[model samples]
Target: MRLTSGPAHSLVQLDTIPLGDWRALCDRALEPNGYYLPDWEAAVNASARGRTDTSALCVWNDGPPARLIGLMPVTSLRRAYKVPLPALVSGHPYGTLCTPLVDRDLAEPAVTQLLQAARQAGARALLLRDVALEGAVMQAISSALAREGLKPRVLQSYSRACLDATGDGDDMLRDALGPKKLKELRRQRHRLAEHGPVSFDIARTPRQVALALEAFLELEASGWKGRRGTALIQHEGDAAFIRRAAPALAANSQCEVVTLRSGDTAVASGVVLRHQSRAFFFKLGVDERYAKYSPGVQLTIALTRHLCADPAIASADSTAAPDHPMINPIWRGRLVIGDVLLPLRARDPLVELIHAALAARRGALDVARRGVHILRGLRTR
Candidate 1:
């Protein structure tokens, strides 16, 4: 389907994105973030059953065969899940990041068109949540909305830990965890080694990822996440999603599975998704039996060193919650993530009410998180 040009740029719904154009956009226009990959989107859409249907708005520069500039996935919420007003969000139940697929250079025009089209398309509030604050998406959205006389409310903000994989290995580790902590970690490793030789493996080949994934799922299922029923293997859809996505990612050398073994037993395992020079540490699990020797931290240290030494990886996202006890201290680098609420209707009162509710929810969550941190500190003391 050909897109007729709007006043500034052409607007097309994602379903209307011409055949083969989605592949081109993913290949050429997007950054190497796995969440933005076309395959990932397909998987998310395939899995969307009960919660909400996935929707997207595509923006293009005016052309006979219009040049695609930006694409953002959004879901409509209308009197569903207790949400009173109609809303749009750039995330799904299974996905992590919410960055738009826009060229950094064409961000302004693309975002301007996107916002205009989204409003006209009957979105009452545009929810840009779980996205990087310093990324091109946030920058473009902030500027475009401000210029359009829209003041986007920041519903949530937090510092997410990440790893600079391009740095000198020794120096980076020293700065991140400190010498004393490293020494303590080393001592812990020595204690674990007394049981058997502890080995770390980074699985890249299809066979390796396949094998490591099984161990990973099992290890994850044997932990607190499993007890809480939040582990990937515990969720049928999430488990299937990983099983389907990991191999495709490995085929392109975009996936890595790491494992820490003690003799014949797997103690800790993790999954990392790569795209170009960036990697996202997706998830990990450790045996509760190895808690004393800190197998999880040990595995992370090994992965950190491996990432730092790898010439192909320049950065690694922790993909962890802000103030995560396990990853925060180990990865000193931080990435700003925030949720922004943009009004979709002209002088919309529903947007304001939704924002207020969201703000209240976020405030309560923050207080609870602080309480958790305080309790953790007390426990440590």
Candidate 2:
């Protein structure tokens, strides 16, 4: 296989080598971090399932014991600055606080070499959006990349609250709940258990994850998400990928998937990537059949309580829609935040103008909503 970058601080043109040798690559690269998991390729493939422009960039050292310092998920496009860059960047899929996973020892020269490859590949700017600003590794990455003259912006406009799950069920609950919510949840617990005993299960292998996913699909299909074509299983590859990924990612001591079941059936499930005290909620699928019982809400309560029981798990992260009501209440502290960062270089002036116009269009819709609200208020008065 051809090498992308090398020693002596020499930068080679980075072209993506195929996945022919990824098994060996991942065997060496898979740890708590670094971008060699099957899921990385799977995610790229998932995007490719729809678009043709996305490309996965992997840059590594050349030698007997070669190591990868960085992998940037960039897509080639003719629009901006001419270089390919990440699609869901600023740490894709939320709450990873992870990069492609670089060897700290070789990070500087390797990233410099990596950036050289990025430039040669036609990228103008590197965008790391929706990221945390205070973490140690991130600080290191920021400093190193800044040396290359790349801009890293820290936006305080958004923030996320994560739950700590290390104590014990009660302690976890105490931390995860407020007085009002605690009482409401206690009532929910009583209501739910009356129908049947509610329980939680943890799945750790591909086979187990697959079965869990199958059940999740069935439950999800029974819900409105299936009608809207939003079920994870709607796309066979996504189902397969999640099944493939959850197990592999769970291998990390911090990685775990929690399930809340009603008797024998799963009503709610959450995939959390526990890294350095943070339980990043990777994926969640709920059965709405128990909507009256609010199985999902109850599950979150149980998980939050369970998480709050463990001190090792500092946070139960809900890296979902910022405005999502379900997650905002589970955690008591804000560890991170997110925003959709749009790339500017890929668009022409006309395209930029159109996007700007779209923003105005959305503003008009918001105003119309307000007007309707006012009309209702006036009629009620």
Candidate 3:
């Protein structure tokens, strides 16, 4: 249903978004975000936990054939942030990044229309989570806000590991890991190889990806994540979402499942998504029995080489937490990600209230987490 009277903008249920228009927008998006692409995001909205309530704020260019210029999947502020406010938050698409898709040619107007649509939806602000703080899309957003005598406020920010994949794969790895670390990794690889001929394989075709995803799910379910009940396979919705998403994205050459195997045994695997010249390392699953061999790190090293060797890929986002021990050392590059608050009106007081509420909530959560940790420590002692 249209959320605004103007044909230029509307808020419609996520699953109801037109695929042709969505794909067209994605093709010419001002900043590419694989997580927001139609195939990936649609599956997420349909099957991912807590995503069923998503709605897309869509901006259209009213041509003889209407063209979609911008789209962001969002949910109610109460549901997303538990703040009971008139706002919206970017819907989680099973990835860390949530930059919206905006047509590069119509970026300025599209962003203006997007904010207007949010306003029409009765929102005083828009909370975009896990967006690239310095990316092209954010620049467009800032420009749009500036014209309205408003500005986007960064609520939270962190630097995540990324990869500069433009250089020679071997040279990049050698420089990043250094001789001593590289030698140790090599020794680990040699010891691991005693199990069999260790090899790295990539699945790009839909059929190949579908098959490989099974191995990835099984491998992930056999590790620490499994015991902690956090593996995708442990949740029916997460499993269904990925199962549907991977093959569909693979069909368009936008997805790959990489596996590192020792003979017939799959030691580690990961899902990677591509958009424009960038690749996102989505998630990794490893057989912890091979932890001593650093199978995850070995797979990552191979993935680093694999991505660097691809001429079309200029960079890769690790999509990991800030200062992630596993990938920070391997991929030395960084990308600033943040939760930004876009005020719908100039100097809206609600914006400040929302910001304060979020900060307080964050502080309380941190304190509670510390308390839990201390309590557990005391119990153990």
Candidate 4:
């Protein structure tokens, strides 16, 4: 499908978005979202299941050389949230943090146009999931909504682990984890070294990243995720996505794979993505055989130091779940993320119905998940 040009906004298929315009938007975006970068998003759309139908809601500057001022990948509400409403929801970008790319200079107008575009698409509301609730982009959206006698309602919110990379890495770690816990980790490291010299390795070049990613996949598949059939490598499409995305992003110095090794044996590995001055720790995989050594935590510790030492990086998003046991204690900074519902028209009755449907769906899913957990626990006992 070709990009459909319009006066202000157009809904183009995700894969059809112009690369040059998308890259320009990312460069001048009010905030950085590595997952939404063209290379990563394109890879996901092409190879990830349920993502092939994704479309990009674009707001343009309509210049002699048209500039993309705002871009968001979205799917219909029924497809994404099973809500029977005339709304669109942000597509999952293979990772959390779906804040849209809106040019900072044209933010207010770009957002106003985006809302209009959604309405033109016959949507009564626009749902943005996993967005930075307090970020500049959200602020612009809120302002735009307010001017039109509307407001964004946060459907759900949580504080996730993040890293403030400005200060000394060692000092930051010490402060976050405390001396006693640090000592215990150090002890674990020493014991891990008994197998061989423990080392942290990072793969930056395309070839290096590709090789490290294979190792990461194998490690992830050898653990609990594999047992549950949820490892990326377990699915052909997901495996293809990371395989394509990692190397492409690495070529631009936008991605890397970090591995923790005991001598020559890989114990833990993770993929990290970069955009602007911010980094995203995408996913981590560990070798269960080395569980006692806490290889995953060890690798994260090294990653922390590595990112902190980088002069260009200002912060890192863990991209982990709320209060993740592995990362929360190590990265003390918190980023408030949430799902926001943007009402497209003032006093629209459909907006309330949409909100209620979403809330009820979420509540039901939570209960089902808890029930599953209880059943598993009982089985173990």
Candidate 5:
């Protein structure tokens, strides 16, 4: 599909975009994570109960055969910054790393049109949150903004923990954790084995996933999350979303359930979502009773080895917070994540003010948090 000059973009309802076109555009995008997948989006909608603000900003080729080239899912927000200024945000809060599904070959034109269409739809600004600073979407947005002479202000920026599994997982682990640390980890595993026969299991088939997921939910609920009242079972919508989405992903061979067992009981478990050569370490839970043995870390080690040995997987994205206590030390690699406020038009005073306010607030919060961290470190020392 070639862009032939004139107006080639419009805002279409999410349900209106054809399935084939939606999936094709998603795959064509430089980076397509599990969170941005069409099914995942549907799962998010299912969990949304009834929020009518959702829509897709689409870009297409004005040709003899008009074809969809790019898409960005957005929801309208009213009364942002205590004012009646309407703004657009990509995806729901639960869904992180929202990026437009655009063909890289035509990224500049597609993104330009996307911004124009969004602006025309009464969106004062595009408040993209939890965006990957070094991702293809960010790159495209930067290029598009530069081409159109628009300036995008950063609301905040931070690093996210990730794992580069392109090389041997064992080798990567060995390098990251020195020989002494590796020996200590092995010893810890041996200590864990003293309780029972320890093993790691992977569930790929539908039947296995169905059964393991129940155990996963149970295990997750039995840990700190349950005590803190933040477990999936505590949130009905999240549980429902996982139940519907995981099976669908498994049916397509895109989901993997991994569990570390102490004899017949599950001690640690995690969910992995795969798309092409990329794998996302979505979530995990540990058995609190076995906290002394560090079952979660043990399971992560097994997972690293498993992913590294597999020829199909090129990388494993931690999908974890930047300073995650457990995964960061194990993975070491970093993913650049940021929040960028892009003006819908070349000059929008309201948008500019809102962006500046958000940036200032985020900066102050960061400094305050850093001060607290420093005080805590000093106290410990």
Candidate 6:
């Protein structure tokens, strides 16, 4: 791959790549790649409208046909007067789980070339996060940047869960819960069924998704989540994003609702997301009136069975909090990845030192709040 460098505009370097070029590269590089999804499209749309200041480019293999083998999102941060101006190329507000959208074979070269290009453009540094594709990408790029005399660091320390689809729902549950927890899960499930008929439905069509999401809102508002002002459609930003992205989010799949219905009334409900071959239990809400039955736990069990019945899915990706009791027990296998943490690095040496000292004191407050109990025990004892 050839390299070129120069500040693009007020943005700097590769982000200076015209938007047209960026999108064209993104579309070509990601469309047929392993991790392509509508979220990427949404990111592009938002970037085009100035809601974002991210830039990216397609890396092509060295060949006559010139195939798009990788892509990166570049962001420029202005320096604070003291430190050398450094630009960051990362999966920012625009990304969470970012894997290069190139032929798997070209992942290494693509990463190396992209960073070298950034260096040539005069960026003092770069960072990559939420990396899901190749470890080689991070290592190779960081090495390339280092040879150019700039310090590059790769931090590999985060975990994400991915499901493997091989056995019956019973098997999956057994794996998640082991012997003791599985017994509890079964007990809760039977208890819920005794109350009345419990229905777990995944809504794919537009009408059904709309109805189901509406119920999710109601369920969320019924419990302590609502008491503390935590609702699914809480903030206008969240509601607006979901509304705008609904069509694209559902183009490949829809919202999964696990509900316990006694006659016509829904007693408990949880929201699930089925995307491609992965099914995620994203959110859940149970009416406080139905708390006696451990609705959330039972709903999870039913969803596990649904996952078994669906041949397209493999593992359950629990977006549950790191220490979630119900979810942690049920998900044993782990896939660790990188997290993008943005810290202020560039600034005037002496003055910035003062700022850093102040920031360190504030950072200690974050470490002190370890027992922040936002979630109460809605689960049955």
**Regions of candidate 5 where Cα sits further than 4 Å from its true position:** 1-7, 48-53, 63-66, 79-83, 93-95, 360-381
**Model 3 segments beyond 4 Å from truth?**
379-381
Put down candidate 4 lDDT per residue, 7-116, tens digits, no spaces: 88988788777898888888899999999999999999998877776897999886877688999899988888666788889989899989999999989989989888
* lDDT string, candidate 5, 1-381, tens digits: 111223587776676668777777766776766776666666766674442335778889776567777888777544223334557767653445666677867778788888888777777788776777888778888888887777777767778777777888888998888899889888888988988899999999877887788888998999889988877767778788778777777887888899999889899999888877778888898899989888899999999999888888888788787688988888888988777888766777888677666666667878999999999899999
Clash pairs detected, candidate 6: 69-102, 82-348, 83-347, 163-315, 164-315, 165-314
Model 2, TM vs. native: 0.70
What TM-score does model 6 achieve against the real structure? 0.68
Q: Each model's number of backbone clashes?
A: 0, 25, 0, 0, 0, 6
> Worst 10-residue stretch by lDDT in candidate 6?
1-10
TM-scores for candidates 1 onward, in order:
0.86, 0.70, 0.97, 0.97, 0.88, 0.68
Q: Which residue ranges in model 4 land beyond 4 Å of their true spot?
A: 1-5
- lDDT of each residue in 97-199, candidate 3, tens digit only: 9999999999999999989899898889999999999999999999999988888989889999999999998999899999999999999999999999999
Worst 10 residues of 1 by lDDT: 1-10
lDDT for each residue of candidate 2 in 203-309, tens digit (9 for 90 to 100) = 66655665665676677666777888877678776566556656666554534567777677787877665544556666677877666676777767767766666
Give the clashing pairs for model 5: none
Give the 10-residue window scoring lowest on summed lDDT in candidate 4. Answer: 1-10
The candidates, ranked best first by TM-score, are 4, 3, 5, 1, 2, 6
Clashing pairs in 1: none
What local lDDT does model 6 show for residue 366? 63
RMSD of each: 4.2, 6.4, 1.4, 1.7, 4.4, 6.9
Give lDDT tens digits, candidate 1, residues 92-201: 53545677777555667878888876766666778887788787667777788777677777777899888988888778889988999999999999998888899998
Rank the models by lDDT, top first.
4, 3, 5, 1, 2, 6
Tens digit of lDDT per residue, candidate 6, span 278-350? 6666677777776767777777677777777888777666654445676565566565556322222233253
Please list the residue runs of candidate 1 whose C-alpha ends up more than 4 Å from where it truly belongs after superposition. Answer: 1-20, 29-32, 48-52, 64-67, 79-81, 93-95, 360-381
- Candidate 5: worst 10 consecutive residues by lDDT? 76-85
